[model samples]
Target: MGSYGTSMAARCCVTDTRPTSNPWVVLATLLAIYIVNYADRYLITGLIGPIKAQFAIGDAMVGMLMGPAFVLLYVILGVPFARLADRTSRVQVIAAGCVLWSGATIATGMASGPISLTLARVAVGVGEAAFVAPAYSLLSDYFRPERRGLAFAILGLAAYVGQIAGQAGGPAIAAQHDWRMAFYSMGAIGLLLGFAALLLIREPRRSGSGEGTVEALPLGQLARCLVRSPAYLFMMFAFGFGVLSGVAFGYWGPELFTRAYGMDPVAVKSAFAMNFGLSGLVGMLLFGALSDRLARRSMIWPCRLSALALGAATCAILMASWAGSFGTARLAAIPAGLLGGGWSVGFMATLQYMLPPRIRAASTALFLAVTTLLGFFVGPWATGALSEMMGHDAAALRLALTLIIPFGFLSALLGWAAAGRVERDRAALHDALSIRPAAPLLARPAAEKG
Candidate 1:
């Protein structure tokens, strides 16, 4: 197993000696695209009330729209798209994805019924699935291993930015125009960004000393290698639990604020935008920088920091769920957003350390598959069903939110456990594969060898 791991590393990992241009430009462009990416996807959540009234539907149907309508195809197509990213130009894959999803979002505006809207959302899923894995893979190449936490965290900040744009802007547009116009507007923004990505972004050289000497490893072997690692399994499960709680709240929290606190749609949208934007941004920057610093001491610190942050996030979320007033809920959301920001930076940064370069994109796709399928699909759907079962009232929604809190704790615990094993896994990869930490972009020689 060790020998195979070493050989795989030697075959797959590229050591790019060619000096690159400012990688931060690449990071900024990708970050902008993700902001648009998330804004288009999450815009629907803020408009749930208007959509429900328009279609004469209930919370369960809205949950389906948020969850399964997109996630099913999103998870299914992730691997194949990720494979394409691995084999071809990642920038092109991302540009194509942006166009496809933007087009789908525009079509959603024309959705006259639930069926048309659902199909449009499914198309959005297919487009988005193409973006994430490849994007992560691209970022990994632009930044060094040590700096990835911050780079990825900067990318992760898009979630909050996108949500802010969607939640704040979507409802405001809907208030004046209608839900359909909001969709059309956001979709148009994405289309513009997609074209910019195609024109401005340049693909970086893949790293590894022996890149042309060996063929890429088969996907079967990569899957087998990952499955056999205790560290990978633990990290994925931890990510799964965290994503489940996070998605459920993100998708449903707006409705809860409206129903339970009697806030207007505009008020809910603004509050959510501010809450996610300010708090999540603080958390991402703080924890991402912290993780990078602590990682200098030990690989385990990132996971440990994540474990602690997850616990903080869980407590904050619980406080928000039970808070009687809108102001109190917003206050609670601060910690939730801030701490929640750390999980991606910490765990994913840790995962980057463990994985060989060749398989990074696929590993990310697999991570997304598990998290999206269970977290995005089952989490919101189950919450909606639970609320309906409990009577479809604000109180029932509160209860449903309460039930998912345990998953947060479970996730924190998994991170704690995973922290202990991360070093061992890193050691195994190093001892067997002779892999060392990657040099930061521009640190190597400027000349490329033919």
Candidate 2:
């Protein structure tokens, strides 16, 4: 194995500066795009009631529209989109994706019923799929392994910003003008931002000679390498379950308040925006910084912290499930959002540290497939199904939400199990990639390797 210490030192240096590139500029531009990403993605969640009333649908149907309907295409296309990002200009890909999703979000506003709206959501998902994996790859190039937790934390905060805007603004817009206007306004904002991303964000020069040339890895080889790492497998599975819980809350929490507590959609969404969204922002920053610090002591620290956060988040969500009033739900959101935010920053940092730059985007796509498929595809639908089965009332929804909390504990256990194996798996991957001094170390083109 290449010396772990040497590789880490090299990564730290690479992260510090690209000499010609301004990473902050890249980050700022991407942040704007991500905010639009979530705003378009979750805008519907805030207006579920109006959509349902118009279509005369139940919770299960709404859940399907929000979850699997969108996620199917999102997860399915992620790998190819990531491959495109890996082989092409990531900036152009992201810019194009932003435009596609923005247009699709606008189409969502034009939908008259479930069929048209669902199709528009599918298009939105496809556009979003193109953005995230590549964006992570770009950020990995901009920041070093040690600083990645903080970097991803900062980027992850865009979700809250988007959620705050979407949840708060969507309901407000819907209240004043109608739900269609809510979609139209957010879509317009995203379309403008898409053009700005194309104009403003210059893709950084690729980092590290470890990967030699900018050649794509064969998907088979990439899969083989990942399958060999137990840590990666466990961590990915942990996130699958972990995100299931998060999606359950994020997609349905607003519904919970509106239905269970007799709160106004605007009031419920705004309160969630502040309580849960802001709490998550705090957690993302705190745990990201904390994970970075602890990682200097041991690679396992990131996993350890992730497991800890999952445990805390499970408790917080369970508390919310049982709360008797809107005020109590707000109180419960604090730790749930805080701890939930840490999971992404921690796991992303850990996973990136273990991967070669050549396949980082692909690896991220793979991870997202699992997480989004389970969390986005299954969680929301399952919650809605349970709520329907139990009686389609406030009490039933609360019970359904409570039932999802146990999976959070399962996620924590799996994350903790992966902690002991991270360093070893990281070394294994480094060795497999066959590092050399300065020159790119990964496989050259097929002809060159032959």
Candidate 3:
């Protein structure tokens, strides 16, 4: 098994040593595109109330729109798009996706009923499926491994920024005009950004074997390479479970404020946006720099730090969910926001570090597919179903979110498990890629094994 995996990794083509373009400019353009990507994706969550009222639907239906509608095609097409990126221009793939999803977002605003809305969302998913994995692959080539933690962290800001734009700005626009107008406005912005990314972002030479070489590993071999790494397996599940709680909260949090406290939707979204967004921004920068520094000593520190942060964040999420008053809930969200920001930087940095360049995009797509299917599909849908079963009240919603606490703990445990095996996996990857001498697999001293 180990030898086969090594052969598979060794099959990867060489990376280009020549610089392709300005790394900072590429980063800036990709970051801007990502902001639009996330904003378009989550805009519907902010308008859920209006959408539900217009369609005369329940929480379950809303969950269907939020989770299954978007995630189904996103996961289904992600790997194929990633494979295309592995062989073609990742920049072009991303540009096309941007245009496609932006068009879908506009279509969403024109949907006449639930069916039309769902179809539009499915289209959005198809478009979005092209972005993340390819983006990560591009970033890996543009920035060196040491700087990736910061670069990815800077990129990670899109999540919070997009969330704020979608969750807060969408509602604000809806309050001023209507829900459909929010979609139209966001979609238009995305179209312009899509063109910008196409024109401004240059694809960097991949960083493995030799210049101008692209290797297309068979799907079976790619699967074998990923599965053979225990760290990758554990890390994948850790990411999936960690994101479960976050997806649920992100989708339902504003509703919780409105239902539990009778707060206005616009005000709730804006407050949640500010509280979570600013804290998350600070946390991402702090943890990104910290992880990079600690990584100099051992890669394990980043994973350990991620686990610790996630565990603490879970506790804070529970506190926010069960808080009696709105003020208390907002206060509790501060810690959750801060700690929740750590996982992405660690996960992205470690995943890229452990894989060869040829497989990076495809592997990332697979990882996203699994995590999105598990977290994005299950999180919102389960919460909605559970809430309905418990009588669909504020208390029921709180309990439904409470059920997510165990998954958070499980994620942390899995992260720790991944941390224990990361060094070994990284060593094996290094040997496979022939970046350094191939040390005897079992000859390492016990002290250095992990």
TM-score head-to-head 1 vs 2, winner: 2
Clashing pairs in 2: 209-440, 210-441, 212-440
Find the 10 residues in a row with the least total lDDT in model 1. 441-450
Whole-model lDDT for model 3 versus the true structure? 0.84
Count the clashes in each prediction.
6, 3, 5
| lDDT scores of the candidates, listed in order | 0.81, 0.83, 0.84
Clashing pairs in 1: 6-433, 14-207, 14-208, 15-207, 15-208, 15-209
TM-scores for every predicted model: 0.90, 0.91, 0.92
Q: How close is candidate 2 to the true structure, as a TM-score?
A: 0.91
TM-score of 3: 0.92
State the lDDT of candidate 1 residue by residue for 80-197, as single tens digits: 8888887778899999999999999999999999999899999999899989989988877777666778888899899888888888888989989998999999889888888888
Q: Write the per-residue lDDT of candidate 3 for residues 361-410, one digit (tens) a residue.
A: 99999999999988889998899888888989888888898987668889
What does candidate 2's lDDT look like per residue over 1-450, in tens digits?
A: 234666543444354444434666777888888998998878888888889899999999899988988899999999988988887788888988999999999999999888998999999999899899899888888777777788788888998888888888898999889999988998898889889887777666666644334787788777877887788989998989998988888888878888887878789888987899999889889988998999889879999899989988988888887788889989999988887877877888888888777777888899899989888888999999999999999889888888875788999999999998887777666666664322222333222437
